[model samples]
Target: MNEILILSEDVANMVAAGEVVERPFNVVKELMENSADAGATRISVVVENGGVGMVRVTDNGRGILPDDLPAALQRFATSKIKNADDVYNVKTFGFRGEALAAISSVSDFSIRSCRKDYDGAEIRIKHGGTPSGVPAPAIEGTTVEVRSLFANVPARLKFFKSFSAEEREIAKFVRFFSVINPNIAIELSINGKNTYTATAGMDMTARAVQVTREKDLVYGESEYEGMKLSFVTSLATVQRYRKDMIIVGVNGRVVKDPSIVQAVVTAYHRMIPDGKFPACAVSLHVDPDKVDVNVHPAKTTVKLLDARDIFSFVHHNIKNRLDDAGHDQGVQMRTPDSTEHITSNSYSRPEPDTKYDHQFATQSYDIASEMEVVEYEHRSSAEIVHIPEQSGAESAVRVVGQLFNTVIVCEKDGEALFIDQHVAHERVLYEKFIREAAMTVPSVVMYEPLLINVGEDELAVAEDSKDVFDKFGYEIESFGGESLKVSRVPTDVLNRDIEAQVKGILADMLEERKDTSVDYRALVMSCKAAVKAGDKLEMHEMRRLVSDLFTTDNPYTCPHGRPIVFKQPEEFFLRKFGR
Candidate 1:
């Protein structure tokens, strides 16, 4: 048997530093959080050499007392909480008191603060040297400067990716902090140059737009039970390529919660392309008692007591806001009355219970008396008419005709619409499958069960996500070690190789937990069932397809993120002809 020894204070702190500060970004995160908790309306962070060389955070918040400045650098010392009971009811960003002690252990650290009507004081420490306080300028805030991070531990410094990489992480964390804490103004300086800043007056929506440099955005808010959620999300038209932009904050503290991320992504589901992600900053305000933020070493992870309720709340709120954005995201189209275009624009948008007679023919009339045709003689046929698909549908809108045997051209109000036939159908069928299946898609039993080979981790995912697979329209079970038994498959996917798709579903489920995600079972089914490009269509077919498309949840894009409808502004034709 081995004997145990109590580690010295320096060694214990260095060990704890590993968990509290993994990289330069983490140091920035901790300091930024402390600034916010200090009630600083204005905070500034300066980083150099990817935070390995230096990090200085200054905030215009309540300054620490001269007496408390020294103790603030010691482990297990925090004024945010006084007793064990205070841990459960923490409302501040920092309560553990481990940040300063852990951070100062591995770096040259110093803190300066001055309360109102008091002399300013500063404390300094360098790799276990004796800490001492000195007189500082009587500033009404706190400034923490850390230099030579991981300098004491060469091993830690060697593991860093690069200076630029570290700088990016610091910048990323500060951005989230600024947006999440909209009431506070935050500034970031990298490599001696100011790079990013957020205004204290700006709300979450404005902050999000400024930070992302994306103008196409929307705002949503909802309060249910005891929880409140506010969001600044990108419109479907905006294309951010990664899910990393979906930032989540709990009770004003930025956190790493997968549940919240999945909910937000699912809310955008078919609205955006599957491979794309929306840039959303979600602020969740809840009672401190309802959440436990002490779960993670760096205080990044949190466990919500009512996680499921919060998920639904976040998902439904974002979903409803997007739904209200309408089919064209506020694009205005007035009824067209131009010469040579179709007439009788008297169609009313259908009511939920209203049924349309698909069998009826479209109305038409001669445009000779309405207006004289401009001699379009100068332009060639190629210049004047591009092939879309054939057009039909209502006299309410003019089906200008088809283009390239693949797209449908139509004029509505003042805009000329280009609709993709294949994507239009895909979007339609996708909505149908989702609506019909509700929670679980109907699976078809196979004559013979398929045997699939999988690793232990995948087998666990297959078993755990059996219900998710069911939602994806599959009935799968464990066939034993390194293998899975699939008895049935979604009716839409019967023709595709069940074995290959099953493996794919498992791999996907493993990435995102099976409990929260569905493999988008209808995606494959809808794609396979949709019309292909180059398929010729009649005028009535184009019109009908367009009509069906406009009525879908999203007419701007298809299920897989392809644009289903595009518009050429009314000015396009005017400028082209020198009219």
Candidate 2:
């Protein structure tokens, strides 16, 4: 009658299986990691029925040994680490041997491998953690096959999603890994068809082109403190995710550190439109140890030894590229009106602040006063501001002319502003959209409220914001079980499909929480509705955009750190024309 009884080996393994083999995707992750650790130049993954029925991973690596094949599939066994101390300096991708053992315990699993120096070997194991026979001769490299995942654990089987959903998740992981290790060739196939392939040892631009199918209009490259930083960014297309394809790496490993991503976002802030994510590939080559890769179990995250220094370094690198591309106001050369052409009356402003009651908002007075006194003069509401005296502040130059419904040209004092009219206007419109979004309160709709279904994890977030939504005039009733019914949505967004807008709002709010500190649902809604790059704008509208931009609270950048305006300075024109 002991309170705790010793469980059988089968029971112990089943428990472990629950942790490591949650789904077929988990099996694919483990096998892919093993193949990566084995130094595979090319790794190919094939999955069937979302990996519920079959998952196969083949690698052209050194492969496993005949003598070690049995031990490799045993519980708590690992070749990557010998003792506990080795955990600190561990570099291999697959350090936990629990992957194979746990996978074998819950599904039919087989491994075939051959080291370059030895003969091939093969082994098969079934659910309940037992090997059938000794290792036998096989082909070179490694091929792992897992079948009927979670068959022994029907409870886990219940968690299996639709095959297409699971397949997408697996495909996402494969693409992530492929992007991280561009030097390693990777091929991912769904069922029998190849879904994706990456060229081995391609440069960052090449890799991005191959993976994203988007052209790499790399602006430029530069070095900071002896470490080279390259900017592989697109001119027009932006990503459709919370984190736009801004992948940062040091010494060839992928990292998701906020500081690094923040720096890049900050650098581009105000250059792009609000709520739109730019596609960028920023690769930094520095000493490997500067980054500690042992921070996370999956190594998708990392710790930078000098996070601040790295942040500043990368921020400046991107900032300089933007400036050189005539993305900053100060150094650009063009007509102020032509660069940011608005209608004659579109750039209206408040009367000059002669009363000196600037105390209402003091912190940003210098910038505001400059705009009020200098920018508003000479330019109609449709015209852009041109400031020759303030060459240091690139933002002083505003758009003067919008040509061919595509390019914006701004000139002030001795500087000119030439910008991709679409991108610049997108930034302006996006900012306005964000402002409109923030001001709009949700309206209560009494007619059969729409129900928003969410998982348990998302329930808390929805609940916490319920009151906030109420303030915006939205009434949400809890469905008692695990869902929320929306009785109302914001009125301004009424033009959009109610269901689609609400769903988009919720998803965007959740993503904003992850991407930036501003998590208000209203703000997220605004960001998602903002105009995107490649959106066309008329000349007068572009001019109005420039005028409105100068009046914004954070016109220098967007909410997410992308620059909305680029300036051309007089010095550049003087240098080119020799005074």
TM-scores of the models, in the order given: 0.58, 0.54
lDDT of each: 0.75, 0.63
Model 2 Cα lDDT, one tens digit per residue, 72-129: 8887798888987676555666465677887888888888889977877888888855
Model 2, position 33: C-alpha lDDT score? 76
Error of 1 at 156 (Å): 0.9
Instruction: List model 1 lDDT by residue over 1-579, tens digit each.
Output: 759989999988899999999998889889888888888999999999989999999999999999888888889999888888888889898798899999999999999998899999999999756897788999899999999998999988878976866776677788888888889988899887887888777878778866665555677787888788888876666544456678899988889999999999888776766876777899999988989988999888999988998999999888776665552332212222211112232322322432222223122222441232223333232322222323634334577778888988887768898888899887876776667644434445666667776544456656666654665556789886457887766554555656656655555444444333323545544554556788788665665576667766787877667788888888999999997
What lDDT does model 1 reach? Answer: 0.75
Off by over 4 Å in 2: 1-23, 134-138, 219-231, 236-241, 248-255, 282-300, 324-326, 329-579
Candidate 2 lowest-lDDT run of ten: 355-364
